[model samples]
Target chain A: MTTPNPTAAILIIGDEILSGRTRDANMYHLAGELTRIGIDLKESRVVSDDREAIVEAVRALSAKYTHVFTSGGIGPTHDDITADCIAAAFDRSIGVRDDAKALLTAHYEGRGVEFNDARMRMARIPEGAELIDNPVSIAPGFSVENVHVMAGVPNIFAAMVAGLLPRITGGKPLLSQSYRINRPESTVAEPLGDLAKRYPDLSMGSYPFNRDGAFGTNIVIRGQDGAMVEAALMELATLFPAEEHS
Target chain B: MTTPNPTAAILIIGDEILSGRTRDANMYHLAGELTRIGIDLKESRVVSDDREAIVEAVRALSAKYTHVFTSGGIGPTHDDITADCIAAAFDRSIGVRDDAKALLTAHYEGRGVEFNDARMRMARIPEGAELIDNPVSIAPGFSVENVHVMAGVPNIFAAMVAGLLPRITGGKPLLSQSYRINRPESTVAEPLGDLAKRYPDLSMGSYPFNRDGAFGTNIVIRGQDGAMVEAALMELATLFPAEEHS
Candidate 1:
């Protein structure tokens, strides 16, 4: 019996990203990590630091997917409204939790930094939520319902995902193999489609690349079964002949 | 009397992006262009090339926003199902249009390449849709109702945006200025909030960065009015004092 893959959606909350002030690092990092761990990253949304948008997105994503991972807006500023928004989405009360506060306090004291009111806001988490660790910074992320909220900074977000993903159950890891053909995508699309039809369970993707004035296509075959993936890759290698590109 | 700003949402369609095989470049480029043209980019979504998901997102975003821009899935592959999904979204008939076919024919003929069936698939356009130009490659993108579908490749997407944006009416360009302060966000949050309240029309965003073991914040002030943006920047500079950072 095959267990279906657990699906995830990512909600990126920050005005900087939507306004083009910052190129997102967290979404790309999380997508790779989730894919590796057998959790299918189905969709990702980027919304500005608006309260209503955040709450609405959190509610919708948490309901539709097995997990909803959010990055950004959990900071020490007025615009950092994600924690409150998450609580509002789930209709739960939120305030500074003692455990979270103690963690931040100890870290701040160790670093000789003042744990001011704004910094203290980091400890504010929804009721009945478990804290996700932030090894880079002491401020903890939290998982409320199906939603996991993490810091926007790339390093901190990566650290949080490392701590969080192991606890969640995932299905068999999706396996992928690629073959590079020096021919254009148009030349490869027809035969590739036939190959795809023969193996209905696997997904085939053709990504075209132009490197140093030479056009080529990277065709990736992906599926949950390793033996099936290997079989498909072998067929693709025979059809495309890898030595042409090498 | 102030007219409301036109709002837009971007739908990025591809499995490579969701699977972390490719980092997205189109969303960033589109966001910056939309911001410059005074269209408020309210939301952006990245979805894998699943038919139902694509159709649902296209319908929802088109209904809610002033304009919806979609990138990706107009290629010569089996997984390139965006055109069909778009037709299903609007309940329109789609087939290879003569204009699109002509363009691709000329491009391939000029390059001494075959204009085969797979390449001809790029010419398919939904009924009552207008073609968006693709100077990078000859395949045309299309605009149906408020939805504009463009190529996903960065260069082609950028070129299409250049060709398409000028044709649409835009509001006053959103003006912005940034001041980098060599202080933690905790140190700057209180006064920044006060300053934000003083200029309610402008938006204040505090982006924190940690570089080389030192922490700092970049405060960005944005609004439609140049005068309001300038005023906010002046206050921020005086409050933070760039000389301190220097």
Candidate 2:
């Protein structure tokens, strides 16, 4: 049995997110993708455009997790300083990159948009960094050490992450299954606890959800081993029978 | 005019959020609410269930922002140690509270469900903490110092936050207006930049949005004064005319 120690984390930066104007859609997509890649995402953080706060979080989480991903604040606006702050975190300087510039120029050329000074700012990369390709938007994301910096906008960031994932070293994806039991967590806690103890590798969760003014619980079982997940599912099935489809 | 330093921030705790399994819905909701309340949401962080991570985030954000609201890991599961970790951040011990016990017991009684040991675990509160009433579930969330701990689930967390907001001190609520500019950000950047400089107290944002297979931009002006918002909107209208609903 392999130890589940291959870990990853994310750091989301933006003041727009903190004030609750835009609901973040990137976290779920990243989570599902990371799980499939077999990287144990152990932590995530959201900080604003503040340089000190960004530097502190990046330094600390990078030391703890094997890989770190950040989203947002890497734009042309004055508040967009994710790249500079990351460079500071690693004690590096900010510099323009030839590869990133070429990509940005090509991207704008295809769309018939002039690559002006404000647009050129997108090509700036941290010193000694590798670019993460973005298919939707030509402006590339960058990686410094263990930290992968992606865009804040959902469409662009999601596309960028998709293009970048295969290159990273990841473990086997975790197996998870959920069943909606129309009962409170209390009704299922006893049996679920026993099942969890029996299969020590499996992580069981009971989330109580409200649907149509009635409460129900969804019990999820997750584990690295396919067989272990199957075993947990079998026990759950015995407790709550599957609904027959007509 | 006040320095407009009514500060607030959010601390989201969960491996799921960082790993990208759950895209955070709470951050945007809190940001919008705080903005309306004139609390400048300066930072947001997503940390895992690990003790040190949670402790560090709570300590840092609470110190930086006037109010720090956290969501997630307040469940009955073993990984749900938000309460304990937060208490540790404040250099306090976790213990069962008589008030929480009474509230939880009454809540379960109304639903005709017996409160077991696992259910009672939800009643654990940090020393010298006040409760944030959860309207959805009877299990109360606690606040010690300026750190307000709410559940990770969106619905429950939102309800608790709505309940807790009136109790905290807030500055003048911000007013905002948005105009859809058919042209790209480039066409508007120069004028918008000039407007931004002219209105030092207001924050003018030009967001590029995709609508009906064409790229459209929303130029938003946000500030505490309604008169400032109206003045900015008038200037922007002269630059980019509104779509006539003829």
Against the native complex, each candidate's DockQ, computed on alpha carbons, is: 0.82, 0.49
Question: Worst ten-residue run, lDDT, model 1 chain A?
Answer: A207-216
Which stretches in model 1 have alpha-carbon errors above 4 Å? A243-246, B1-3
- Please give the RMSD of candidate 2 to the true structure: 3.2
What is the iRMSD of the candidate numbered 2?
Answer: 2.7
Clashes of 2: 17
What TM-score does prediction 2 earn?
0.89
> What tens digits encode model 1's per-residue C-alpha lDDT throughout A48-97?
99999999999989889999999999999999999999999999999999
Which structure among the candidates has the greatest TM-score? 1
Candidate 1 lDDT over residue span B141-223, tens digit each: 99999999998888889999999998888887789998899998888988998998988788899998888868889999999
Tens digits of lDDT, candidate 2, A57-99: 8998899888999998776655567899989999998877888
